[model samples]
Target: MDAAALTLHDMTAADVDEVAAIESRVQSFPWTRKNFADGLAAGYRGWVVRRMGAMLGFALVMDAPDMAHLLVIGVRPDAQRQGVGERLLRRCIDHCRQAGLPALTLEVRPSNERAIAFYRRHGFAQVGLRRGYYPATQGREDAWIMTLALAADAA
Candidate 1:
C-alpha cells in the first residue's frame, strides 16, 4: 500500500484492541490495552495510520515541559518497511516542534537494530544507556537513550 496517502487520525478507545494486536505481533514486549487506556487518560498524544480501511500503525508521544518522549510506536508486520513508521515518527517530531520542545527522546532496546537504525536515519542520536530498561525473554535488557534535537526549521 502507498502509506503516503494513508489518513492519520487521533487514536481512540475503540482503536485500542487493534493497536494492541499489532503491538503484540511486532514487539517482543508489547504494551497492553490497559497501557493505551492509561496513556490516553493521562493526555498523551496518540495517532493512528490507516488506509483503505486498515490500520497500518500507531504512535504515542508524551510531552514534557521541555521535551517529548516517544512512549510507543508500533506498525503491523504487513505494514513494515512501507513507510508507516516513518510517517508516525514524523508526527512525533512535528508535535515537539509545534509545542516548542527542544527535542524528542526515546528508549530502544539495543537488540532492536532495525528500530535503532531507523531512528538514526530520522536524526536521532544515542546519548546514553539505561540498565534493565526493557524486559527480556530471560530477564532484562539495557536500552539506548536516543534524542532528536529539533531545529526550528528542521524537516
Candidate 2:
C-alpha cells in the first residue's frame, strides 16, 4: 500500500467488523464484537486508518480526569511495518495532549517485544507489571504497564 494514500477517520459501527477481523488475526486473544460495541456505547474515542477505503489499522482510547488509557491498537498483518501502527499511535498520543491529558497508559503483553520496543521508541516507559494479565494456553501471562507523558507543545 502507498503511504500517501492513507487517511484516518473516526471509527464507526460499520468499521467494527473489519477492525475485529484484524484484531483476531493479530492478537492471541482478541476482543469480541460485543467488546467493541460496548466501547463505542461508552463513547470511547476510536479511530481507524485506511487506504483505498480498506481498513488498515485502528485504535481505541478512553479519557479519564487526568489520564488517558490506550485500550487497544491494531494494524492488519500486511500493514504491520508500513508505518500504519506508528501513525495510529502518534495520532492517539497527539489527541491525548490536545485533551490536556497529562499521560497515556497501556498494558502490553510482556512477550510482545516488537510492540514494547515500538512503544519505547515513541517515549513510553514501563512503570509496573500485572501478573497473569493475559490468559495463555499453558498458563497466564504477565503484562507490562507502560506510560507516555505527553508534552503539551507536542500537540
Candidate 3:
C-alpha cells in the first residue's frame, strides 16, 4: 500500500465507538467504549489512521515528563500486516519526540509473539517483566515490558 494513502488524525469523542469496535475485533481482551472515552477524558493523546475515510487503526499514549507510555493500540483485523499499524506507531514515536520524551514504554502479553517481534523490528527492546499483569483464559498472563529509547539523532 502507498504510505501516502493513509492519513493520521487526532482521535476524538466521536471516534470512540468505531475505535472500540475495531479494538474488540482485533483484541481478545478488548477495551470498551468507556475505556477509550475515559482515556480521552484523562487527557491521553490518541491518533487514528484512516484510508479513504475508513478507520484502519488507532493508538493511545499517555505522556509524561520522563517518558511516554503507549496505553493501547489496535488495527482492524482485515488491515493487519498492511503497514497501517506501523504508520500509527510512527505517529506515537513522533509525538514523543516532539514532546522531548526520551523513551516510550508499553506492556505486551508474553504469548503474543507476533506483536513482540513487531515491536522489536521497530527498535523496542525488552526492559522488564510484570508478573500476572493481564487476565488470561486459564488464570493470568505475564507481560513483557518493552522500551524504545528515543535517541537525539534517531529518525
Which candidate wins on lDDT? 3
Q: In model 2, where do residues sit more than 4 Å from their true spots? A: 151-154
**Clashes in model 2: which pairs?**
none
Q: Can you write out model 2's per-residue Cα lDDT over 69-149, one digit (the tens) per residue?
A: 999999999889998998899888888988989999999998999999999999899999999999988899999999998
Query: Clashes per prediction?
Result: 0, 0, 0
lDDT of 3 by residue, 1-155 (tens): 77789899999999999999999998888989999999999999999999999999999999988999999999998889999989989999999888889899999998999999999999999999999999888999999999999976466
Residue 26 in candidate 3, Cα distance off native in Å: 1.1
All-Cα superposition RMSD per candidate:
1.2, 1.2, 1.0
- In the predicted model 3, the residue pairs found to clash are none
Q: Tell me the TM-score of each prediction against the true structure.
A: 0.95, 0.96, 0.96
Model 1: number of clashes? 0
Tens-digit lDDT string for candidate 1 (36-122): 989998999999999887898999999999899999999998889988999899888888888999999999999999999999999
Task: After superposing candidate 1 on the true structure, give the runs of residues whose Cα lies further than 4 Å from its correct spot.
Answer: 152-155
Error of 2 at 38 (Å): 0.6
**How does candidate 1 fare on TM-score?**
0.95
Candidate 1, residue 11: how far the Cα is off, in Å: 1.0
Backbone clashes in model 1, listed as residue pairs:
none
